[model samples]
Target: MGVHPKESTAQNIENIKRQIGEIAAIYDWDMEVNTTDPEFYKWTQWIFVQMFKKGLAYEKQMPINWCPSCKTGLANEEVVNGKCERCGADVTKKNLRQWMLKITENTDRLLGDLDKLDWPEKFKKMQAEWIGKNHGAEVDFKLEDRDEAITVYTTRPDTLHAATFMVLAPQHKLAAELATDETYHCPKKTMVYTPSLIWKFI
Candidate 1:
């Protein structure tokens, strides 16, 4: 995301070098800045190329919640008190192309190493909470009109006898249409309709 505009080059490059030095100092690492050095840019470019080679970097269009006035997408962790951080405007969902880090592909190995870290009890608990590990079977629901089935992950398969209702994710493509079906008894107003489906399974 860092780029040096040629017109603003000299001043911006010096500022970047200064910030890098400050960050290194805070981390107790010794480093020096040589802004006029071509080696620096070469290293940066090589890092970028390595990332692309590993298929870790790519661009795509993603639907996101954004505030037009602020011109930035709101991350799930960024929404606070129902206001935009940059412009104080109400955020709205929009379809736009955006870049995302592929952390899902690395989730398993990351979680497996959690116990190896020496950390405070509270922080370890938070880490476990963030991982939210659950072991369960994949169950499929047959759609009425479609030949295909929708699969949902449930950690409580042993409690199948008490199935009371079902809930589907709002982002699920079939949710809106499924909500109106007579056989399924989909509740009209809520996004977290899992309990509705779970009830039926009971």
Candidate 2:
């Protein structure tokens, strides 16, 4: 009983509503709410429009966790082990135009306001941990043959001089650029580089 973005069209919504109605009637349940209903979604759309007007919502092209099977982008919390949490399908990074809400803009306010809530201590602690406030400086490392520099954020900038090796995620844009050997490049665009080669360059 799930409706994905692709199946949220007028015709498909009507079909889903009819199906749900039949099921509710058989069960004799008070199913007064239908999210697919235009009357309901219009308010949701209005709220989004208002947010956009206030500069709280914006559209940008960025790397996102994409579920190929579902044909939709997912949030960071919706992805598990590089897979879609809903469909259990392998998720890949895709640069797509997406609507982003400026939640970070209210981070400090939200964190301070949490003190007013009557929540359990453990729950409050978890929420605070999730917010993850940290003071750090971004230091750039120059690449050997490239004009580009890789920036690393660290809380302890003093220890950065002693750092010998650096690791980048397989999907990182620089991982492919830094890979010199043909074996490191794959048809699926997954980059793999040797530690020795990376150390030699850096």
Candidate 3:
């Protein structure tokens, strides 16, 4: 049976459970639980509630990676080069209200405790890079004919004077603003061009 938007969620869940059961039986694997079951999700909900009560979980409005094909919000780790890691679809930036977990608060402790783990050197290095914390200066660029300014973070503040052109990522929140101006036109054929070539006014 094909799983489509028209299919009921209950039917899809049942289909998944059946397929997993068949695979488990063929592989002689012992599958004790189905996370889709109500009992399992109850505990998951309880944990989220506990985290919210402890202030570790909170909601905020922010820019997030969105997969248009999947129609869902994705985490930073789930996006690679402005594409969805799971579906390989082009991802875009979307501003929406989302729940956020304050994991950065433990960045220092997490980095320091990494050495104590038995993981390989490569794995440790990757974790350290993922927890990337760096000091940078926030520079604001005034928009042409617009009162708003875009703020960018850069480690090399001295090199700002030599910058001749501004390139914003396709998934940037401000990229959509370029379309509002009639003078700035991006050709549809050059959509895949690197840097997206939004506005060329120099």
lDDT (0 to 1) per candidate: 0.63, 0.73, 0.74
* CA RMSD of all predictions: 7.0, 6.4, 6.2
Return the top candidate by lDDT. Answer: 3
The TM-scores of all predictions, comma-separated, are: 0.53, 0.60, 0.57
Rank order by TM-score, top first?
Answer: 2, 3, 1
Against the true structure, candidate 3 has what lDDT?
0.74
**Winner by TM-score:** 2
What tens digits encode model 2's per-residue C-alpha lDDT throughout 17-61? 689877874543465555767888899999999999999999887
Rank candidates by lDDT, best first: 3, 2, 1
What residue runs in model 1 are displaced by over 4 Å at the alpha carbon?
A: 1-63, 68-71, 94-108, 179-202
Deviation from native of the Cα of residue 173 in model 2, angstroms: 3.1
Q: Candidate 1 or 3, higher lDDT?
A: 3
List runs of model 2 lying over 4 Å from the truth: 1-40, 65-91, 182-201
> What TM-score should be assigned to candidate 3?
0.57
Any idea what lDDT model 2 has?
0.73
